[model samples]
Structure formats: C-alpha cells, structure tokens
Target: MTTLAIALGALVLYLIAYNTYGKWLGQKVFRLNKDHIAPSIELEDGNDYVPTKKGIVFGHHFTSIAGTGPIVGPALAVMWGWLPALLWVLFGSVFIGAVHDFGALVVSMRNQGKTVGDIAGNVITPRVRVLFLLILLIALSLVLAIFGLVIAVVFRLFPQSITPCLLQIPLAIVIGFFVHRKGFNILIPSVLSLGIMYLSVVFGNLGFLADSNATLAAWPVMTWVTLLLAYSFVASVLPVWVLLQPRDYINSLQLISTLALVVVGLVVASLFGGAPIDGLRPPLEIVAPAIEQNVTAKQLPLIFPFLFVTIACGAVSGFHCLVSSGTSSKQLKCETDARFVGYGSMLTEGFLAVLVILACVAGLGLGLNKGDEFLTGTAAWNAQYSDWASSKGLAAKINAFVTGSSNFLQSIGISATFAKALMGVFVASFAATTLDSACRLQRYVVQELAGCFIDFKHRKLAEPLKTEKSFQARKTSWLTNKHVCTITACLIAWWMASLPAIPGASGIFGQPGSGGVILWPLFGATNQLLGGLAFLVILFWMRRKNMPIWFISLPTFFMLILPAWAMLYQIFVAAIGSDQSWIEQGRWLLVGIGSATIILEIWMIVEALISWKNLQKTAIQQD
Candidate 1:
C-alpha cells in the first residue's frame, strides 16, 4: 500500500474508534456518568484537584507526555522498513497505548485521585504496590538516562540549536512570570513566547551564536550533563505556573506547527514527488538465511516483538502510566474527564505517528532509490547504500530538510523565522513540565514506601500508631520533597548519558541504533506486558462493577500473547550465540528485560491472588 493510503486509513480508523467505540467504552464500561464525582471530592486540594476544563487539561497532558521519545522512536523505526513501523504505530496506539493510559487515569480517579503506585496497593495489596514501585523506579531511571543521550546527540549534531534553546529559558521564565505574576492570560503570553522563540531559531541560522564563546561555545560532555541535571533540578522545584505550565502551553503550539509543517511537506512530496507503483519493495527480499534464521531461531514470531517495538508512543507507553497516575489523577476534578483527555489525546498522537510514517513512505524513491535502499538490512547494503547515496545527492537533501532550509521554506519564508524564534518557548515549557510531573511521581513512591516502613516500625502489640499526616508532611518537605526527587531523577539521567559519551561505552551496550534491536523491541514487548497487567487490573475493576469482561479481555489476551512470544524469541536469540556482535547484544538485552518483567509479573500475580483470597474470606465471614 502507498504511504498516502496508510495516512488516510489511519485517520479514518482513529476517528471511528474515538467517535463510536471509544465513546461507548467511556459511557458503558468506564461509566463516565455525570452523576459520578471524582472520589477526590471528599479531600480536594485546589492545586491538584481543581475542576479542570477538558481541553486545557488535554493540552497540558499531551505536552507533558510528548517528549523527544516520539520523534526518536519513529526516526529509528525507519530501519525496520516504513511499513512495519507504520503498522505498529497505527495499531498499537489504539489498542495498547490508549487503553493503558486512559485506564490508568480512570482507575486512579476511582480511588481518590491516588497515584498509580498507591492505587495498585490499595486496590490490590501492599505487596503488589511494592513490586510495581520497583518496576517503575527502574523503568523511570532507564527512561531519563536514555533520553538524556537522545538530547545530547541532537545538540552534538546541531550545535546551532544550542543558543536558541538556551535563550528560550529566560524568555519562558519572563513569559511565565508575565502570566502568573503580571496577571496576563494565556493568549498574550503564548504569542509573545512563540514570537521570541522563533527569532532565536533565525539567530541560530545566521551563525550569530555559532562562534560566541560566552553562550555558544561547545562544552565538554560533562558540562552538558551537569547543565541538563541542573535544568531538571530547577524545573522540578519550580511551580507549574512559573515554568512547567506556561512552557507546555506554548510548546503545544510548536508541536502543532511542526506537525503541520510535516503534513505540508508530505503532501507536497507525494503530489509533486510521486513514486512508481512499486515505490516500496519488501525489505525482506535481500535478507540472508543467516539473519532470517537468527530472527526465527530467536523464536520471535517476527510479527510479535517487531510490532510491539516499532509502535512506541501514545499507546501503551509505561512512561505515560506514571504521569496519568502521578499528578494528572490528583488534578482531575471529574471522573468522566479521563476518557476525553487521556484516551482522546493518545488517539491524536497515534495520528501524528501515522503522519510521520506517511512522510517517510512519500519521501522514499524507487529509482535512483536513495531513501528506499538505505532502509534495507544487509551489512553490505548498509555500506553500499551509504556510499551510493553520498555519491548521489541524498546526503545534501537530507541535510537541508533536517536543518530546516530546504524548499520547505518557500511556502512560509516569514512564518518560518517566527517559528524558529519560539524554539526555546517550546523546549523549556515541556522540559520543565515533565520535570515536575516526574518529581510528583517520585514523591508519591517515596510516601508509599515511608508508610510501609512506619507500619513495620510499629508492628508490636502496642497501640496502633497513627502515621498519616506526619509521614506525609515529612515526605513533602521542600528540602526533602519534590525538589530532591527531581534533582535525583535528573542526576541519574545525566550519569546515564555520560556513559554513552565514552569511546567504547556506547558500543559497550551494542551498536548505537541496535539498542532498539533489544531496547526498543523489549520496550515494546514489556509495554504490551504492562498492558496485560493493566488490562487485568481494569478487568477486575469491571467485574467489581458487575460488567462483562469479553470486550476488554479478548483484545488484552491477544495483545499479551503476541508480544510475549515475540519477547521469548528475543530471549532465545540472546541465550544462543550469534556471531554478530550487534544482534547478540540486542538479544541479551531483550532477555534481561524480559526476565525482569517476568519476575515482576509473577510478584504482581501472586499479590493479586492473595488480595482475592482475602476478599473472599471477608465475604464468607460476613455471610
């Protein structure tokens, strides 16, 4: 199928899901009845429990979850052939990601706007909560560490993007102060922020900061790491009104604008740069027995892990579950709002992924085939195409578009400058927002842990010790609270990035992109696994409400089995020796992650069984 067809089909399917099935799921299953209030009603804090407008809340939520991850994942997914990448993104988003995210929010809202970790404990049992927390902490550390590397790579490649990003912070701070302190509303601050950030981009192009030692000098790797950690520190401590909220508000515009540009480019490329009927060739054609055998021997059903790995965003992202259960739930005023903001926003991101896939497909060339051949997977093909594409003009065209100086400018020469200026506005906004969101989640985990310890401390046959307010207050102290958690989070992330900077360190894990061969693919598999866990939890929740389980259970089971088999393949490959270093490392990494997930899943299963037994015992005793 052509790229255009994929894009149109994805859009149609998403709209249908959102309008019909999603709506039904919300009303009938999720029961977003207007009569129902968020359980937080008994204990609303205006800061976190303010009645939020769904549109504003969605905008806030989307910007927070949409990070550099989406861009990086799709960009790399081009490796597996655009078709594999496209299908994973399109299907996974709706079935797995949207369900996980939307369900996390719904579950948390049902339980007094508690964080995900807390809800798991209260609804399931303390043992389940503890296990879930460990999983989250480890997962989060991996996320921050890897993502720091992504940002560093971009900066290393495009030194020009530095000054613009740096300049954006103060501009965002000023705009944020303008809105909150100076009492301006969103519209004016947003315009001012965008205009200024766009200017910074133009300045970057002019080479103005290219040589400025004061602001633009290339620092050592350690310096960048330190700077990023410090930024995370401040971002986590700062109130959402000061930096996080305002910045995200503006970045939302930037994201929309970028998406629009991509759409426009794809349309222009497709209409003007149409490929032959066979524009896309099966990437598998040139594959050798060795590689295919390895993939098969790995026992990876080919479709299972591959599909899960490729579709990394909006749908079934474990990261978003943290956010949904973290601060978002606390702030939700109405239970029904989860369906619109959580489920709806993910559908939107899914559409964006489809659009990106379409862009790649449209840009692929059949003859002279610069883009298409570069996508195939033989070592010789990689080396040969790298030479051929360079010998041709492929490199230059790619450079131009990436640097944002291609014919893409002719359409919006002026607006382009304005957009560039707002680069800082977008970065600081989302970066700060995510920082705080991360902090809130960390704090929630800490509080839960503290409660466990305090309970253990008072286990004697004396009077039951009350530990609610005192322990919570200690956990929330500014010195010991969100700021500390944020700093800790960022520092750990920086440490991870620094490892990649070492000459042999990056390859120590595996070849650079091949991290996904293990990391991305396993991430996909575990993500689906998490979906299984989430589905079970939600299924149990539904049963509690006397609802039928078929609708949720069937898809959940299929998604679960498919990805598990895929992960098993990866584990098999890792366990067996492949001569290829890159694939070998990838196999091992997948096995490691799969093993950890299985252990965690087992713990979760046992906890759920115990909780069920206890409930049954209580019911019998009552009878």
Candidate 2:
C-alpha cells in the first residue's frame, strides 16, 4: 500500500508540476514561440541536425539521460532510508531537474543549437565559454569511464543479459535503414524489432546462445569493458538517425515496459494478495532508526548534502544539461516541443526513480527465496548493505536492486531465474545507451575545444588543414576529426575504468578493475555542481533577455552551495583528516579533480555576476 501510494503520489505531483510550473517556464519565462524556426529545420543535413518528431526526439532524449544513474544513485541512497530518497527524487525532479533540462534545451535551440558551454561565450564571456567546456569535458570523461565500467559489470554479473544487449545494435541498424531510407512506418517496425529483442532475451536465458558458453564466461570483466568502449567509439562516430537515435528509441521502449511491469506487480502484490503481501513482502516502513544504523554500525554523513548528491539523476543531474543542449536541442522540430522532450522526459525519469526506490525498499521486503531457504527483507537488505565502506558493498548494492526487482517479478508469477534475467537485461541496456551517448558527447566537446586552438580566420592554415595537405595542418586538424576524437575519448575512459581498485579502500562492493568506484564519491558533487553551473548559465541568458530570473536563480544557488559544501567535507575530513595516506586511499586524484571543478564553477559564477550587473546598467541607460 505504501509502495502504491508513493508511486501514485509522485506521478500526480509530477503531472501537476508539469502542467503548472513547467508550462509557466515554457510559455512566460522562456517564451517558446511556435513561429520561431528551430535549428533542426534550418540546419538539416540528413545527420545530427535533421528535424525529428517530438515523440522520437523525446524517446532519444529520455533513454540517453535515463541511464544507470537513476538506478544506482537511488539504490545507494536508500541506505539512508527510503523516505529521504523519496522526497528528494520527487521534489527535486519536479522543480530542479525538469527546469534545468528544459531551460538548457530551449536556450540551445534559440541559440542555433549550440551547447550550453558554447552559449556561455555569448551570454557571459568568451573566457567562461572555455571554462564551461573544460568542466563539461572532465564531467564527460568521468561519465564515459563510469558508465562503461557499470555496463561491463552488469554483463559480468548477469551473463544472460549479454545476448539481448548485443542484439540491440543490429536491430537498431535495421530499424534505422528501413525507417530513414525505405520510409517504412516506424511504429510497426519498432514493435517488431522490440519483439525480436525480447525473443533473444528468453533464448539467451535458456542457454541457446554462445553467451552462455564457458569460453565467453572465462573472459575477465576488463575484457568486456574494453570491447564495450570500442563499440562506443563506432557508435559515437555514426550519424544520429543511423544508429544513435533508433537505438535509444528501442531502449526507451524497454524502459517503459520494465517500469510498467514493476508498477503492476507492486499494485497486485500490495492490494490483491492481502496477507501474502504483508508476510512475504511487508509494507514499506520508514525505519527511521535504521537510517543511522548500517551493517558495520558506522554513522553516515548528514543526510542534507549527501542525499542531494547521491540521488543525482533520479532527481537532478548536471549531465542532463549536456544532453539537452548537446543532442536534443539540435533535433527538435518545433521550439514548443522543448517542453515535452526536455521537461516531460525528465519527469518520466523521476517516476522511474520512484519505482527504483520502491523496488529496493518494498520489493526487498519480499525477502530472498533461495531453494528451500528464505531470508527476510531486513536480513537480506542488511546482508548486502551492512557496511557502506567495504569494497564489496558496491556489488551488494547493485545485486540488491536485481534481487528486489526479481522478487517483484515473482509476485506476477514469473519464474525467479527469468525474472532476474529480465531485470539484468534492463539495467545493462540502460547503461549501454548512456555509455554510447557519453562517448558521442565527449567527441563533441573535444571537437569544440579543438576548434579553439585553430585559427579559422587564417584560411591558408585552416582550409588546407581540412585536406590534410601540410604536416602542421594535419596536426592542427586531427582533434577535429570525428574518429580521432571518439577513439581518444574511448581510450581515456578505458584507462580510467581499467585501473586497479585501490587496496583496502574497496568498499564492500569493490573488485579488481572496478576503478570507476574510486571516483564515485566525486560524481554527485561534480554532477550537481555542473547542474548549478548550467542553471547559472541559464540565469545569465534569462537576465540578458530581460526575462523573469527567480525561477532559475533559486535552483542555481541551492545546487551550487550544497554540493560544494559536501565536496569540501569529503576532501578535508573523509580524505585528508583521516589517518590514511591520500595516495593510498585514492583521495588525491579525486580531490585534485574535484577542487579544480569547484574553482572553475566559482570563476564562472563570478563572471556571470559581473555580466549581470553590466546588463542591468545597460538596460537602465537604454530606458
């Protein structure tokens, strides 16, 4: 009953927020004019800038942003209890996440499809443009590395998922070719392709494929990570509609189906089953006492700052800003569509996050069924989450979601093995979509940054560089090459992912080659900080246009201060204040990177303030 309440309540709030606040921002604040020509129509090239229907663009945008962040972040944050996580995911998504995403998309669309970082130059200053790009590059590098490791880990832990996950590539290609080239109806073909993918899921679980073979099983996690990164390199370089757009469309379908299944299962288990729901999977209890009690009996940091950082994508993530401006803005057919594609899609992700919380909390309450033995929900959840600091705890956190999701499926009469397999495929597919998109975004960042070094005014240098005629020109143009940028981005991410997990610092979930976890502590701070910076950028743009500034300002200030405070605590107390050596503890690298990001953010904020004052003065003078 509690699960159903939370789920329905979140949905209602989101709908209200969308209709009221989201619409207000779109109509009054941003003034999204339907008559305005978007970049998609103006710059159509049968590639990235091709005009797309709102539905297709929404699918692409949703899947790209709805990665493992929503899943993993909420899964981890449930450690502090479901209530705190729930409130943040609900309120944060409605107010902060949707607004940030919508503003970024609309601003970019109005600015000729330029990225947020690129638009900073015009709105703030040229120097801030480079600074914003630097922040984006660092953030994207971590995203590429972390998501790649996450998908690889999913494949390793759930072998049955590999077949369906790998099948998405070819299926998407076929769909792309038929719809874009042969002009087939996208709906029928997409449904058929999804049906085929699900068939692979069943067969893969039944061991009818090579994925279950001993040879593939013997390969290390790093091997899978390497292959995934290589694949992302190719996916990143392809034109949007050819592979990226269609693939994300299919993934979005899978996500919707999964969410629907979980919701239905929760309702049936909670309302219809009566005693079974209570005895087997008990109602969700606030468990306020346990919030401070972990398996290891260590107290976590105060919920204020950490909760905001932890429940990142499920609530608000800075990365969504990049997605809004980087890709979605370019593909919008109508300026008005930004409200749906940008704002509505984020609310959808928030609902998914709500379901994730229910799955981890209420679903886990169903307990673990192993053969004839059973563990209560409390015991099972505690067993995996006893110690947040242990290296192995990361694996436990991920497995908790799988186990709980499978339990939910069982309530609907699905066999446990198939249930687990289904959930595994869902998670792996989500991560794979994010990994490829990050690679593509990173390539864009690299190219944009590389352009800064080129003397575009010197045609002798720039024009010949396009032909690779002179050695100097070739050197200058290499960074601008799509393939070069993609490969370089992949390799860097691969290196970060492949590094050895720090000894003794591995949380209970840590494993060798799980280097991405080392950087996890910094992810929330950096991500939210990026959100703050993005909001700041939006605020500056609004001020310049003489629009209402309060809507963007509050979130900007809230996001900036909380995450920065949390990061400072992490640096001074958790990393340096403790007796552990910074290098041995793996805090040095994170501290340095996090500090640099904070500095860049502060610099940009200062620049925006100065610009705001000048803009005010100029307006007064004109008046």
Candidate 3:
C-alpha cells in the first residue's frame, strides 16, 4: 500500500503541477501567445527546421530528453535511499527541471530557434556566448561518449533487445517517407510501427531470433560503441524527417505503451504482489532504507550535493536544456506548444524517474528468482543494491532497472523471458533515441563553434591567396561542413569510450566497459552545471524582456549553486585531492576534463555577475 500510494501520488502531483504551476509559468511568466510564429515555420529548411505538429514534437522532445538519465540516475541514487531521491525528483522536476526546460525552449523559440548558447550572446554578452558554447561542446561530447557506451552496454546486457531496436530504423524510414513524401495519414503508419516493434519484443525471446541475439550480444562493448557512433553520424547528417523526427515520434509511442504496461504491472504487484514464487509473495515495499545506514563515506559518500547531482535528469538535468533549446525549440509549430513540449515532457520524464525509483526500491522486494531459489523482501533488494560499489558497475546499474521492471511485468502474468525482453528493448530504445539526438545537437554545437574560427571567407577562399598563411586558413572553413562536424563529434566520443583497462571485468552483465561508472557521476555534475548555466541565459533573457522572474531566479541560483558545489568538491576534494584520486589511478583524462569544466563554469558565472551588476548600475542611473 505504501508503494501504491507513492506511485499514484506522483502521477497526481505531476498532473496538478502541470495545470497549476506549469500553467502559471506559461501564461503569466513567459506569456506564450498562440498567434506568435515559431522558428520552425519562419526558417523551414526541410532539414533542421521543419514546422512539426505539436504531438510529433512532444514525442520527439520527451524521448530525446528522458533517455536513460532518468533510469540510470535514480537506479543508482536509490542506493542512497529512496526517500532522498524521491524528494529531489518530485520537487526538482516541478520547480527546477520543468521550469528550466520550459524557459529555455521559449527563449530559443523566440530567438528564431537558436540554441541557448547562441542566444546567450544577444541576452547577456557575446563573451558569454562563446563560454556557453564551449560548455555545451564539452557537455554534448560527454553525452555522445557516455550514451554510446550506455546503449552498447544495454545491447550487451540484453541481446534480445537488439533486433527490436534495430528494426525501428527501417520502420522509421518508411514512416518518414510516407508522411513527408506521400502525404499519408499518420495513424496507420504509427499503428503498424508499434505493432511491428512489440512483435519483435515478444518473439525476441523465442526460437531462432533468441540465438541470433546472443550472437550479436557477444560482440565486445568497444565494437558496439564504434558501430553505434557510426550510426549517430549518419543520423546526424540526414534530414530530420528522414530519420531523427520519425524515429523519435514512433519510439515515443512504443515507449509510452511499455511504460503504461509497467505501470499497470506495478499497480497489480503493489496490491497483490508477484504471482507467488515458492508459495510466498511479499507485499511490495521499499526495502532499501529511508536513509542508508552503516554506509561509510567510502561506500556512498556525502549525499548532499552528490544526491542532487546524481539524480539529475529525473529532477533537472542540464542535457534537457540542450534538447529543449536545440532540437525541440526548432520543431515547435506554434509558440504555444512550448508548454506541452518543454514543461510537459519534463514532467513526463519525472514520472518515469519515479517509476524507476519504485522499480528499484519497491519492485525488487516483491520477488527475485535467483537460479534455484526465490528471494523476496530485503534479500531481493540487497541482491540488486548490496553496496554502492557493486551497484555502480556499468552493467549492474542498468540491469537493476531491467531485472526489477521485469519483475513488475512478470507480476502481471507476463512470461519471464518476454518481460525481460520488453524492458531490455525499452531501455535500449531510450538510449538510442538520446544517442541520435545528442549527435544531431552536437553537430549543431560543432558547427556554431567552428563558425567562430572563420579566417577566410567562402567568397574569397577559391580566389588566389598571396601567401601560404592565407591558404592554411582555408582549411578551417572545411571543418564547418555538416558531415565533418557530425563525424568529428562521433569520433571523439568513440575515442573516449574505447579507452582500455576500465575497472570492471566479466561481471553480471558480461565483460564490463566500466566507463559508465567513471563517467556517470562526472557527467551528472557536469550536466547539472550546464543546466544551471542555461538558467542563467534564461534569467538574462527574462530580465531583458522585463518579464517577472521571481520563479526563474530561485531555480537559476539553485541549479547554479548546487552543481557548482558538486563539481568543485569532485575536482578539489574528490578527484584531485582524495585518497582514490584520479592521479593515483592514472586517469589524467578524467582529471584534465573535470578541471577544465569547473574552470569554464566559474568563468561563465563571473561573466553573468558582471552583466547583472551593469544592468543594476544602468537602472540606478536612469532612476
């Protein structure tokens, strides 16, 4: 009953927030007018900027932003205790995450769908623009590196998920062509795609397909990372309608369906418990303690800043800001869709996080069949999260969600093999959608960054250059090509994910590419810091418009202060100065990048402060 109450309460709370607080932000704060034209309409290029319907835009935006961030973050954070993670997710998503996403989307839409980084120049200062883009560049690079590794890990963990995920590509292309070229109704194709996707998941556990999946899963993580990055490059360079938009749209449909099923399964399990294993079914209850006890700082560390950082996407991830301002802002058909696409999608993700938390904490306690024995209650929860170290393993972290969620589905009479396949496919699909979206966003960031280095104009490049120095500058222009930028983002990420001698070896989810463990916390802090920086851009934008910003101001300060605290601690106290410092581990790469991120963040915040000071000074003079 406690588990049931938490699940139902989250759903109700999110809905109320959307109508009350979310509505207030839309109408009173940002003032989204339906009559206003969107950038997608103003600058329709048939490529990046197509005016998409609100529903399609919402689907794309939701899946792109949600990704595995919600799943993996909460799955790990629940070890700190479900109560803390739950509070941050519920409050942070409403007050901070949703608002940040909504504000960034609206600002970008109003700025001709420019990314938040690009808009920083007009709202704040040009120097801030470059600083913001550099942060975005580094952040997206982490995304590309980490998400590729995540999906590869997922594929390696659940091979049956592979074919179903793979099948979505051709299915998406077909839908893309018919809708864009043939002018067909979207309903038929959507149904057809959904049907095919589920069929793949259902049959994925049976007969020949299962064997084929095993063969595919056996491929090393590095090989899958390379191949996945290659796929991202292709998706990056293609027209949005051809791959990116359609894939996200349909992927959202299938994802939503699976989510609904999982919710139903959760409801059933909470009330009746799983179909009894060994003539016993434990009532669904959170087994992982209210606040973890007997845990050393070595096991879980201080939960203050780290918990906030750890539960990023579920609460307020910085990556969501990029997606909101980057891809989502562009596709919005009208100014009014900002609330639905931005705020609504984030709330949806928050709910997913809530589910993940329950799945890990409550769902695991219902029943876990381990070989010849069935474990329930505390034993079951411990199996999933005995200690932070075991739980942090790249494969262990994700498999926790998969295995736990499968238990929920299995509670509803779904077969064990099929439930595992479904959850596996669901997780992989999410990671894949985010991977593709990140690549596209990275290409945009790369292009914007590259444009800053134009020493030679295109008009004069072909003409005679008097000196060798003049010719050398022409090469920089070539780097701005869409293909080059896309490949550049993928290759760099590939290099990082391919780094050898990662900590874990053949663990529960096969030979681990332990980068996920190394990168997860680092990325969480970096990502949340980026979110805070984005809020700064939005705050500046609101101030310029003379819009009331009491709502935005607190979140801006919070997002900025907390992530910075975490990153500072991570660098000075943890990575550089701690007992198990990266220096000791010979991980100079992590140390170097982590240090650079902190430096960039401090620089940007200082710039914002100066701008604020000037704004106040000018106002005083006017008075």
Candidate 4:
C-alpha cells in the first residue's frame, strides 16, 4: 500500500507541476512560439538535424537521459533512508531538473541548436566558452568510461541478459529501415520489435544461446568492454533515425513496461503478500536497521550536500543539459514541443526514480532471494550498502536493486531467475543507451573545440591578409568530417576504461580495471556542478532577455554551492586526510578535476554577472 501511495502521489504531483509551473515557463517565460524557425527545419540534412515528431523525439530524449543515473543514484541514496531520497527526488525534479532541462532545450533551439557550451561564448565570454567545452569533455569522458563499464559488469554478472541486449541492435536497425526509409507505420513495428526483444529475454534465460559453454559466457570483462565500446562506435556514428532513435524507442517501451511491472508488483505484494507499509513515511527516520548499525558515523556524508549530489538525475543532473542542448534541440520539429519533450520526459524519469526507491525499500521488505540466502529487506540492503569504503559497494547497491525488484516480480508469480534476468536487461539497456549518447555528444564537443581553435588561428593569420573565407572553408571541412572527431572521442574513453584498476581497491568485482567504480566518487560532485553551471547559463540568458530570473536563480545558487562544498570536503578532509596510498592517488586526481571545474564555474559566473549588468544599462540608455 505504501509503495502504491508513493508511486501514485509522485505521478499526481508531477502532473500538476507540468500543467501549472511548466506551462507558465513555456508560455510566459520562454514564449515558445511555434512559428519560430526550429533547427530541424533550418538545418535538415538527412542526418542529425532531421525533423522528428514530438513522440519520437520524446522517446529519444527520455531514454537517453533516463539511464543508469536514476537507477544507481536512488538505489544507493536510499541507504540514508527513503524519506530524504523521496522528498528530494520529488521536489527537486519539479523545481530544478525539469526547469534546467526545459530552459536548456528552449535556449538551444532559439540559438540555432547550439550546445550550451557553444552558447556560453555569446552569453558570457569566448574564453569562457573554451573553459565550458573542457568541462563538458571531462564530464562526458567520465560518462563514457563509467557507463561502458557499468554495462559490461551487468553482462558479466547476469549472463542471461547478454543475448537480449546484443540482439536489440540488429532489430533496431531493421525497424529504422522500415519506419524511416520504407515509410511503414512506426507504432505497429515498434510494438512488434519490443515483443521480439522480450521473447529473446525469455530465451536468454533459458540458456538458449547463452549456455555456459557459449563464447560470450566465457568472455572476460575486458572482452565485453571492448565489444561494447566497438558497438558504441558504430551506434554513435550512424544516422540518428537508423539506430539511435529506433533503439531508444524500443528501449523506452521496455523501460515503461518495467516501471509498470514494478508498480503492479508492489501493489500486489503490499495488499496480498503481507509486506509492511510502515516504512513509507514523510519524515526522516532510521527505517532500516542495517543502515543504522553498519553504516557507521563516518561512512556516509551529511544529507544536505551528499543527498543532493548523490540523487543526481532523479533530482537534477548536468548531463541532462547536454542531452537537451546537444541532441534533442537538433531534432525538435516545433518550438512548442520543448515543453513536452524537455519537461515531460524529465518528470517521467523522476517517476522512474520513485519506483527505484520503492524497489529498494518496500520491495526489499518483501524478502530478497539471493541464491542460498533468503534475507529480509533490511538484511539484504544492509549487506550491500553497509560499507561505502569497500570497492564492492557499487556492485552491492546494484544487486540490491536487482534482488529487491526481482522480489517484487516474484509476488506476481514470475519465476525468480526470469525476474532477475528482466531487471538485468532493463539496467544494461539503459546503460548502453547512455553510453552511445555520451560518445556522440563527446564527438560534438571535440569538433566544437577544434572549431574554436581554428577560428583563433585564422584570426591571427588573417589579421594582415584579411582572408577569412579560406579559414572559414577549412573550418567547415574539418567540422563536417565527423569520423575524425568520433574516433578520437571513442579512443579516449577506451583508454580511460582500459586503465588498470587502482591497486588495493579490490572488492567483489575484483580489480576495478576500467570499471567506473574507480571514478564513481567524483561523479556526483562533478555532475551536480555541471548542472549548476548549466543553470547559470540559463539564468544569464533569461536576464539578457529581461525575463523572470527567479526560477533559474534559486536552483542555480543551490546546485552551485552544495556540489562545490561537497567537492571541497572530498578533497581536503577525505582524500588528503586518508592514509591509504591508492586512495590518495585516485582521490587526489578527482580532487584536481573537481577543483579545476570549480575555478572555471566561478570565473564564468562572474563574467555572466558583468555582462548582465552591462546589458541592463544599455537597455536603459536606449529607452
């Protein structure tokens, strides 16, 4: 009953926010006029800028942003108890995440579909633009490395998921051909593709082609990582409608079905299966005994800063800004569609995060079946999340989500093996989508950076000759050659992932070896700081237009300070104070990255402030 209540309550609140606050921002704030020429029409070239229907664009946008961030963040944060995670995911999504996503999308659309990093030059300063691009490059490099390892880990741990995940690629390509090239109705084929993928899931669990003796079953984690990155290379370079859109569309259906399954299973478990509803409350209390006993005094950070950063995508994420400005902005057919594609998809992700909380809490309460061990909710959760200091904590959190969600599925009469397999497939698919999207976005960032440098060199050389067109043509040729940028981006990610794991950090997954776990500590702080910077960009844009700035201002301030505070604490108190050698090395690198990001953010904010004041004065003089 409590699970049902939270799920339904979140849905209701999101709907209200969408209709009221989201509507006002769209109509009054951004003034999204449909007549405004969108980039899809203005820049169409049968490739990235192809005009897409709102439904298709929404599917692409939602699945790309709704990746493992929502799943992993909430799954781990619930260790602090459900109440805090729940409130933040709810209010933060409505007030902060959606607003950031919507504002980034609308602003990018109005600026000829340029990325926020690119637009930073016009709004702030050109030097700030280079700095912003560097931040994106670093952040996305981490995203690619982490998501690649995440999917590989899922495949290695849950072999039953391997077949279905691999099979989706070809199926998506076929669907893309029929729907886009042959002009077939997308609905029927998309549903059919989803049905086929689920059938593969069942066969996958049956060891149909995934037998223990099969080639894939015996592959090392590195082998899997290599294959996944190779696939991402192809997926990232292909036309959007070919593989990216159709695959995400199919995955979105899988995501929705998984969410529905969890909701229904929760209702049945609470009402009919004798699960307790007392843990589902509004206030912060130590509901889980394992968290109380095992999660010691210093194991976790304070709820204020850590909670906000930890529960990133569910509440707010800087990565969402990249998706909004980088990809979705290029494909929007109508300016008005920003409200639905940008705002609506984020609310949907928030609901998914709510289900992740319920799956970890109420679903755990239903009793987890972990091989030979039959543990209650508290025991299962405690076993995994008890030690944040261990390398296994990441694997534990992921397992908790899988085991608890499987328990929910069991209440509906599904077999436990198949249930686990389904959850594994869902998670792996989400990670795969994010992995490819990050690679593609990284390609864009690299090209943008290349263009910036070329322009500077051209300015120097052409100062005497006044020959700008030659440099302009050279720049166009370089940027249009997408393969060079894409390859460079993929190789950097591969190198990062292939780096040997930190010595002495071994855990259940053994040596981390390119697994994102080594860099996971920096993810929250870096990601949230990116969000704050994105909000700062949006805030400055609105001020320049003389629109309401309060909506963007509040979130901007909160996101900036909290993440910066957390990063500083991590650098001074956590890393430098630690005695472990590997801890010092690995953590200090993250500190350096975080410190550079902070410096860049503060510099950009100051520039934006000065520009805002000067622009206001100019307006007054004109009047």
The lDDT of each candidate is 0.56, 0.79, 0.83, 0.79
Q: Over the stretch 1-623, how does candidate 1's per-residue lDDT look in tens digits?
A: 34445556887989888888778778877778666776545566544454544555676678777664444455444444556666667777777678778877888777777767666766677667777776666556555554444444445445555666666567667876776577676677677767776566666655446666234334554555456657665665665445555555566666667666655644443444422224532221222121222333333334445545445664456668777776667656677788887888788878766654443333322112234443323442333223212312222222322322122222233343343333323333344455445544665565565555555554555544335554555555554455455666665555555543224554323223212122433455665565576666666666566566677777566655665665566565532123233245654545666777778877787778787787668758878
Q: All candidates' TM-scores?
A: 0.77, 0.91, 0.93, 0.92
Candidate 2, residues 1-623, lDDT tens digits: the string is 66678788888999999999999988888889989999999988776787887887888999989888888888877777777788889989988999999999999999989899888888898778889999988888888777766776677678788878878899899888888789888889878977887787777755447536335544665776788788888888788988999999888887788778877777776775412544553544322233544523534556677789888997999999989999998898899999999999999999989888777776776766544767655665655555456312445556777877776777778777787888888888888888888888898888777765553333373364223343354356776888888887887777877775665554312444466766766778888998998998898888888888876778999999998887877776554124343444666888788888889888988888888889889999999
User: Worst 10-residue stretch by lDDT in candidate 4?
Assistant: 281-290
Judged by whole-model lDDT over C-alpha atoms, candidate 2 comes out at 0.79
| TM-score, candidate number 4 | 0.92
Where in model 4 is the C-alpha error above 4 Å? Answer: 212-217, 274-298, 390-392, 460-471, 474-480, 504-516, 575-587
Query: At residue 250, what lDDT does model 4 achieve?
Result: 86
Q: Which candidate achieves the best lDDT against the true structure?
A: 3
lDDT for predicted candidate 1 compared with the true structure:
0.56
Worst 10 residues of 1 by lDDT: 283-292
RMSD to the true structure for each prediction, in A, is 6.8, 4.1, 4.1, 3.9
lDDT of 4 by residue, 18-97 (tens): 99999999999999999998998999977789798888888889989988889888987876678888999999999999
Q: Residue 42 in candidate 3 has what lDDT?
A: 91
Off by over 4 Å in 2: 208-217, 274-296, 369-373, 390-392, 455-476, 503-513, 575-586
Highest TM-score: which candidate?
3
Q: Which one wins by lDDT: 3 or 4?
A: 3
Error of 1 at 242 (Å): 1.9
